[model samples]
Structure formats: C-alpha cells, structure tokens
Target: MNRRAFALTFGLGLAALASPQAAWAEDHLAEAVRHTKAAVDHGKQGQAEVLVTHAESALTHAEAAQKGVYNIHVEQGVSHLKAAIAEGKKSNAQGATEHAAEALTHLEAAKKK
Candidate 1:
C-alpha cells in the first residue's frame, strides 16, 4: 500500500513538472505574437528601419516557440518575417507592410495552436 501511494505521488509530481513547460511554451508563443504585432504596426507607419528591426526580433522568438511546438503557422510566420526584412532593405514600405501583415496573421494562428 505504501508503494502504491509513492507511485501516485510520483506521477503527480511529474505532471506538475510538465505543466510549467506547457505554460512556458504558451508564454513564448504569446511573446512572438506581441513582437509581430509591433512589427506590423511599424510597417503600417512606413518606418522601414523599425519594421525590419522588430521583424528580426519577432523571428527569433517565433523560432524559439516553434522549437517547443513545431507548428506550421510558426514556420509560415518566419517566412513572412524574412520577406518583410527583404522588402524593408529595399525601402519598399508597401511590400514590407504586406509581408508584416501576413506574418501577423501567422503569429495569431500559431497562438491558437
């Protein structure tokens, strides 16, 4: 009976440890969405320098989130971020804005997953 009790306690302890990792994955995903949103906002404002900078930041965190969940949306978000950076480099505000908007959509989708 004591052995049974120990097994139950051990299982519960493992579950507790797993829960924090799940929560942290969500936190990292949320952070990616936040940064992507900021990049989109900067794109809309035609601030190519700031937009590129924020897109780089968002891509880094989005990549981290993808490591935790391996979601397709996160992968798509990274693609859009790369496009945004390229457009920003050319000083093409409209193209950067469109790409950033797409990245934002992908980020939101990843958040749901």
Candidate 2:
C-alpha cells in the first residue's frame, strides 16, 4: 500500500472513531432537551413532583452531554435544572416552571451549537 493510501485510510478510521463520540454527545443533548421540555410542561400543569422527575432526568443527560464537550448553554441549562428541581421539591410550582422554562431555552441553544 502507498503512503498516501495508508494516510487516507488512517484518517478515515480516526474520523469514524471521532464521529461516534460526537453522535453520543448529540444524543445526550437531545435527550436533555426533551426531558427539559417535559419538565416545563409538567410544571405548567402544576405537577411539581412530575416536573422534578423530568428535570432530574434532563440534568442527568445534560451532564452526560458535557462529558467530552464544554458548552456554556448546557452548563446554564444544568444550573436551571438544579434550581427547578429544588423548587419542585419545595412544591413551588411557579418557581419550578420558570426555572424549567429557562432550562429549556438554554438546552435548545446548546442543541443548535
């Protein structure tokens, strides 16, 4: 095999390996967005308990998405998720809803990035 061919093959292999990690991060980010939206919806319905559950899930996924990527939007979304969870635990539906809405916005931005 020629040097050029070998280099091309190696580059393609490396690219293939890197793509999976990118896809994994994207998948987790998408999941975080979905969960955050669910939390917002539940909070709107005054279901603090359910909102907390979804927010927790969103936080988990958001943290996972941050494993290999540093995104300010994801970080902000995580913060809002924490606040939402805390407010939900306190049965403050309004506060939780507001936080969840903020989280949704940040997560959506992160997705675009």
* Model 1, total clashes: 0
Write model 2 residue lDDT over 16-48, tens digit each, in one string.
Answer: 988898889899999999999999999999999
- Residue-level lDDT for 23 in candidate 1: 73
Error of 1 at 69 (Å): 1.0
Error of 2 at 89 (Å): 0.5
What are the runs in model 1 whose C-alpha is more than 4 Å off? 1-17
Candidate 2 residues lying further than 4 Å off, grouped into runs, are 1-13
For each candidate, the alpha-carbon lDDT, in order, equals 0.85, 0.94
Candidate 1 overall Cα lDDT vs. reference?
Answer: 0.85
lDDT of 2 at 6: 95
